[model samples]
Target: MSNTIYKNGIFGPNEWAVLEDEADLPESGKVLVSPDRFLALEGSAPEGVELGVVIRAGEKAERLVAHLAKLPMVAIDFPKFSDGRGYSSARLLREKFGYKGELRAIGDVLIDQIPFMIRCGIGSFEISHAPTRRALEEDRLNEVPIYLQPVGRDGEVPLGTRPWARRRVA
Candidate 1:
């Protein structure tokens, strides 16, 4: 059961669909794939597929770095919200691999994690939980505006670090 995606802080529609590792790949639009499923594809796999890869817990980001430019999205699997490995994956994909595309948090995506996930470079989330979906729909998520540690594309300077955090002003 897929719910509306929380994209760019807006509760909006989710056009993408998640498929099993062994399922047949779609020919177009947004499709998220598991790492092993992605690797199993032939080098001659269909082009312009608008692919999004999902990183399971414990999966290394380095293996996906080379494919970053080719993929429009990369989703980190949370499996359980308590597992914070997705945060590391987001940071690596953004900070290290320089992936400017959409970084998504999949699986057990909860409302409370959205703000933190954004800090780690996750641009969107795949929410399936009813309470979570309701929370996002009611605009009850992403309330934190001030942050202590700076990360991701949002250039807000960390808390108490600068008077003019908006920009360099030079």
Candidate 2:
């Protein structure tokens, strides 16, 4: 329900100022991060200021997984939908990084990408414009049912050995 620009836990538009932009930033207990500026930190980011990071196309996704795991939330920036690097980054964050945090998408997000984005690990999405009819349909994506079956041999086992790996050995 919230509509705002974010990175890690910081918020900004095209340009942000350390002192002048206090009004746009969330309160001490809220989180805001800039995907573009996430490479660095600011004056400790209040108390509950969330942080966001931007992943570029073809960049090494593994390098940031460990760093992202430590944070409570992360937002991957998508410069444009045509650029698919963010998709792989999101998948790696969920499958490889084991990041159990709020994974959001910001910048150039549209309706068609919602379902795939959610599967990849983006729980929240920020569309630069007000939700268009197409965008609303994208929100309906939340209603779609997922059909994939239990992936591992625990069949539905809670967690023993990874099913695929065990099958490979068998």
Candidate 3:
């Protein structure tokens, strides 16, 4: 992915390095490890490296609850555009677990799903899709103004008198 990340409404170099399961850990840097690796190194990761975890679609979000505070970033894998499990994982990490760190969506991220992903509390995206990346870069996403579901996020106002219908604050 060339260390390029779209985050906080800007495209910038990604500071976190993703580590392969068989790779050796670097002494100093921000690193994102797989769920299993994260669990194994939970209390014993190298002190110089800031740790993060990438949760796959099938992994349980609760597995990282106790370590949320120490984690600066948590990435949920979409795997495919049809897989909606990452959305729920992001919501659980943000709302239920009270995770205030960066929630990143990785793998199979598409332009059409950006707005919905934001509503679900995913703040960053690691996009590999060429069209999606182009849309993001050009700021030409066709976003829906109204939301049919209440995601319990701040700055969302109810549309008319219907509590279920909401719009994001500009």
TM-score each candidate: 0.78, 0.55, 0.87
Candidate 3 residue runs with Cα over 4 Å from true position: 1-3, 157-166
lDDT of candidate 1 over 1-170, digit per residue (tens): 24467786566777777777868777766678887777777365577565678889999989977777787778889999899988898888888889988888888988788878877878888878889888877878855665545442435654456543433211
Model 3, position 146, has a per-residue lDDT of: 76
For model 2, residues 34-152, the per-residue Cα lDDT tens digits are 43344455445656565545455665657665467556656666788798788888888888778787777766887667666765767766656556334453434343233243233
Weakest 10 consecutive residues of candidate 1 by summed lDDT: 161-170
* Model number with the top TM-score: 3
For model 2, what is the C-alpha lDDT against the true structure? 0.56
The order by descending lDDT is 3, 1, 2
Cα deviation of 38 in candidate 1 (Å)? 1.9
Residue pairs that clash (backbone atoms under 3 angstroms), model 3? none
Residue-pair clashes per prediction, in order, are: 0, 19, 0
Relative to the true structure, candidate 1 has a C-alpha RMSD (angstroms) of 4.2
Q: What shift in Å separates residue 134 of candidate 3 from its native position after superposition?
A: 1.4
In candidate 3, position 126 carries an lDDT of 86
How does candidate 2 fare on TM-score?
0.55
